[model samples]
Target: MARTNDDVAAMLEEYADLLAITGGPDFKIRVYQKAARSIGAHVTDIAGYDTTELRQIPNVGESIARKVAGYLRSGTVPQLEELRGRIPAGVRALTRIPALGPKRAMALHQRLGVDSPESLEAAIHAGALHGLPGFGEKTEENLLHGIALLRDAGERVHLGVAMPLAEDIVTALRAVEGCHRCGYAGSLRRMKDTIGDIDIVATSNRPKVLMSAFVALSQVTEVILHGDTKTSVRTGQGLQVDLRVVPPDAWGAAMQYFTGAKAHNIRTREIAVHRKLKLSEYGLFDAVTDELIVSKTEEEVYQRLGLPWIPPTLREDIGEIEAALAGELPDLVTEEDVRGDLHTHTELTDGHASLEEMVAAAAERGYAYYGVTDHGPKLYMQQMTLDKALAQRERVRELDGTSGLRLLHGVELNIDPDGDVDWPPDVLAGFDVCVASVHSHFDLPQDRTTRRLVRAAEHPCVNIIGHPSARLIGRRPPIDADWDEVFQACARSGTALEINAFPDRLDLAAELIRRARRYGVKFAVDSDSHAVGHLANLRYGIGTAQRGWLTADDVINTWPLDRLTAFLRKKQAAGVSRP
Candidate 1:
């Protein structure tokens, strides 16, 4: 079976974890981890390459390439199997708990005989875990909370995690000789934050050939079924991908039926039924005459139903169908509409790229402006002190006009638990823009969190609120807050809320965006990029905006450079300096 880049990366990650657990050489552990990182970030299919080409990848050396080849050819690596035998799989799972690292988990297994989340939870509840080295009552409490969140999060894969694998599979299907068209359906097409399974639809004359090609792809680790028109397989990342081959004429109807929010389809069918028309995966037909009417394209289907074409991202039956009927459907924000990125980082703090490199990447994307907003002092580990911030500001000023792209010097100011900002007014005033965000106290009471956010929005120097919910998908729940009040506060203070585009942190989720829109609050769809490759994350943010029914005019970053600067200056002029 063909293994995707993610598949190889997952195996390497497992090897690294096992090595760490077994007290293997530090250098070997680091090598596996680095190789995993590099492969996971790679855009192309790693399994299609020969051993020599694999070795050419940045972190893949001779040993790693050989291991990859061995795994791809057979099913398992001998060393990895041996390590698994030495360490129970349960012990590895224990390391995933919030406060537990491999070292801590191993110590627990060796001393307290704990090997899984169940056993650890038992120990904590029995008060047997409190006095352990590096662990206390507070740590135990935190672990319990983390475990609950993990349980609640369940097995859903983040959209970011599943998208690349889905795209690769679609590309492979499209390469089949008889395949006329191929694309993913389901929630992926709808752009949901999390996905349970991937659904792909293809139009092909030779179903068997397409099915064979799909099942034989390197990413398929297990074939669940292979039939004339459908095939299902499980990828290395544990994602179930189901492919359906349909006649070319039924492509549109099949796509609409499969790419469903169920409720949306039900509503559409209701309209068809009322109009004496029938709708199904086959085609739309006149119910009385039993004659086919439309099926070739989705737009034709919508037109027959007296509605305009609905973007896939808004197919959730969340007022989209109604909007279409009224001809009020929004011209949703697209990647091309964004003129700049306002929340980004560089090497002056936690980012990997330099200021100039980041600017060049933005310019390559045709962005007229890009903001350099590194972490502020309160971030501690990656904090930029006042003097460092000033020096960076000067550096930005000196290079401002030299680059074709306009650079905005800014800081991601830390918002404290009680609603205090990291920097004083005068310091914040020196920057071109200020993005205030909550970095700590994620578990505060709802009222307190709302108050904290409201205070930040009310701050005169604050131009935008970054990652309003402060969520790390699959890892942490969103902070509790009165979202309506917070949205109103931002609108009142003219503070734009960010739709942080980082895959792991697409904050101000689609539902919240819709709610905020009611208050006439503006938004900024930002990449929150730290590296050059991260600049491409802007697409995810744009999808989120479209899902929320936002248009280009509703997002500040979509405005031209002059309008954006004028808005920032207006906010700064009204800002009150702190004592």
Candidate 2:
């Protein structure tokens, strides 16, 4: 098999570490690290290249190329294996976990005999890890908490969570006089699901006035950190909100800098640096003239830097700049593109809106159709019964005749750990559509989690996979699984991925959306609304699609009623029988 980029990176990383462990010179160690980085950043398929081509690169030498060739041929780099034997794999895995550095890992291993994450967790639970030499109880507690937090979250939260909090803050801030154009910056602006901290940028002539207004907001119960230009507050929800005031002229530059993934901005700045121009919060400045070039808008700054306007979500330090230069920055999806919502709930289940009320709300939003997918038999918390669910579907059908909206009688079926949904074949076939979801067994191992999800996706009646990872914004991490494998199964099974638009459950983040898109897996941008007010969450779901570089064509719900029905029919025709 050909060597994957991850394979090459792992080998290079191991080699770099071996060089260091062997007391090699810092420059020598850096050479291997550089080679690894160059391999990762290379946009072209390095796996497609021969060993000779790999060696021709500036960083990769003959020895490294030989190792690459061996890895490609045998699926193992002997050098990496040797290094793994010399150093401990447990120590390396510990480094990958956030907050636990190499020194800390070493200390934990030596003092507490906690070499692996499992062992560390055991130590933590037993209260055996309170304080060690050179480490205090506070540090241990922080480490424990960090481990749990990291374990709880994937890389980012779904856009659904980030957008609402952002809007709420903006609304509160906009109430302040002189608070001109208060908007969210950072990943939240980019529509990232899991935001680190809410970055609110306000352009104001009277910034102090706005700042005073911000600190006095009802949502902000206590100010954690405050300053003249910036203020940090702990909200009612366990989230930190940061507000920054910038001059009107510098709004664009400041927004660009502040609403960044940092790495993305650094790459953008590199382009500026190469052009003998400086880009910063102040604005873009010409190096030779030492004069301000662009100051009013982010668009002007990008144009001045000889680049296309890049979206905040695509600002991963990846090859987006080159893509932008090549005019290939994806044409992202918009709110107008979303034709309808799929995985919504009604008062028949745990929802606060009645069937008529929900359909009327969807019609008011000009949707051609809406899927009233209330909770199914497994989620008894919603107090749903088979007879009541059937009655509810009949009621939806009843309203559809007069409502002019094509209503889909759908059920959000809970996929048990054994991969069985609560519905039999007769019941499953009764509904127009079914969304299979995992509501429990969150802490399953990687293989089991992957299997459980794949099994659910493969269900004959499962038209869509609802929140495949079962992540709850900041509170719960996604189930451990090979998402590529899971999405590939979804593609094979003709199951669509639902971007649940509930503020707390944007399960599939933008990156996953991008991956699923690549796998030819379709998406359903669902409101997953529990009440009338939650119908507005469609915007958050649409924002997520945009951030994922999704177009209208990429989403299943964007299709008209007939097209959607045809797609469902096709999926049913091709799918296998449920076990």
Kindly list the per-residue Cα lDDT of model 1 for residues 1-579, writing each as its tens digit. Answer: 122776888999999998998778998897898788667644345665778988877679999988988887886899899988878888999888755788888888887888788888898888887678988777887788767755654377877888888998899889899999999999998888888889999998889999999999999887867899888887876677999999989899889888867767977898999999999877899999989999988888888988888899988765677689889999999998988999999999999999889888888898888899999999999856888988998988887755577889999999998788888777787888899999988999888999999999888889899999999988888998878899999998889999999888888888789879989999999999999999998888888898889999999999988889887777667754431
Question: In candidate 2, how many clashes are counted?
Answer: 6
Query: Candidate 2, residues 1-579: lDDT per residue as tens digits?
Result: 222665687678877765565456888777787677657655344666777899876578887788777877787877678767765777666666656766677667667877677678788778787656666776666667666655654344445555677788899888888777788888777776666678898888888898888888888876855787788875665466889887888889888888767667867788899999998887999888979888788899888888888888777655577779898888877778777888888888888988888888888888888888999978978888889987887788788745578888999999888778988867888889898899998888877788888888888888999987788876877787878888898898888998877767776776678767888898898888888888988877777777677888889899988889887777667757664
Q: Considering every candidate listed, which one attains the maximal TM-score?
A: 2
TM-score, cand. 2: 0.73
Backbone clashes, each candidate: 4, 6
TM-score against native, each model: 0.73, 0.73
Q: Which parts of model 1 have CA positions greater than 4 angstroms off?
A: 1-154, 575-579
Model 2, residue 387: distance off in Å is: 3.1
lDDT computed for candidate 1: 0.86
| Model 2 Cα RMSD, 1 decimal | 7.1
Clashing pairs in 2: 152-477, 157-193, 157-194, 158-193, 159-193, 186-259
